[model samples]
Target: MSDIATAAGGFRYRLWRGLDPLPSGLPTGFAALDALLPSAGWPAGSVIEVITPAWGIGELRLFLPLMQRLSQQDQYAVWIAPPYTPYAPALTQAGVSVAGVVIVQPPQPQQTLWSMERLLRTGACGLAMAWPRQPTPRTTRRLQLAAQSGHSLGVLFRRQHAGPCRHTLPVALSLRLDAAENGLAIEVLKARGGGQLPAVTLVWP
Candidate 1:
């Protein structure tokens, strides 16, 4: 007879199921974008990968609303090794809480990733945004785990290459941003539970 046992005797062992319900997501401030996401918003407690052909394509604009919302929270919105200094007046005008924002500039690339991981695991960081020039698969995986442990939202901005990456790291959401006519176009490469979605364009009002 097989060694495997059945539950006929009311066995205490429980069968493994899927992940439990995720924490409710924070609104993306765009109805269309929110609707497209699996959680109907930026999935909380996970890493979000944003790939772009280059800067100045409304990458920061895409998250302005999210920053404003996070500003109202008790946790800090931290920026790690940003390419350019965040314009305070612009962020303020966007309704972001300047007081709740924190910027960190690490001296070296290695330190940048290290700082990002530390901030995300602090539990007091509401959002940890980083622009990692060359993040390995293992590095991304560690960041994802840190975000989950601290329940923080981590955003990784990567420069778009000529072709798809050889190895795509698993993330809660992966988005590619492109400049559209008077707006930004978003292509969802992968969304947990939501799968891939058609590109959505958001016209600037």
Candidate 2:
């Protein structure tokens, strides 16, 4: 299927499908979630949309292991305008380097997106994340393409629907997260190969 995202300039795109086998990824620590992900870990050099109701809904927990691993490997992990202050003790306990983390809070939303795109495009950060209100198809495409141009993983955490749009996001992975009894429930709305995948319910590591 094909779609068009209209902005000042329109972006036309098709569903993502890679002919090569999915690449290996950093382990998610949550075995169940890793098993369902395109790679054994999160997809590298791609934008992953994570939709959640709130900050503490196991979102950070879901990616902590990956972040820590990247930091240990000397890659910077960045958070652009995160919803809440990251507790240093908690992150340290998780084995993440506090020094390797960069938090940028742009005074304006437009600057925030711009900063995110630049960081992801440069691939200087191992991961770059942002929490923003709904973005236009054009904006999402820009960030998605920027991530593809670099090796960093770009993540957007939203509070709205994560379904397919008429002007679909060029994201390689999309997930909807909700608090579950044991931990969190993740619905894989899209994966590397471009299709609806299964839901993964797991406990916090």
RMSD of each: 7.8, 8.7
Candidate 2 residue pairs in backbone clash: none
- Candidate 2: C-alpha RMSD to true structure equals 8.7
Every model's TM-score: 0.87, 0.83
Cα lDDT tens digits for candidate 1, 24-108: 6889889889767767788888899999999888999888888888887756899999999899999889989789899998888
Using TM-score as the measure, the top candidate is 1
Of candidate 2, the 10-residue stretch with the lowest lDDT total is: 6-15
lDDT, candidate 2, at 28: 74
Which residues of candidate 1, in runs, are more than 4 Å off?
1-20
Residue pairs clashing in model 1 are none
- Backbone clashes for every candidate come to 0, 0
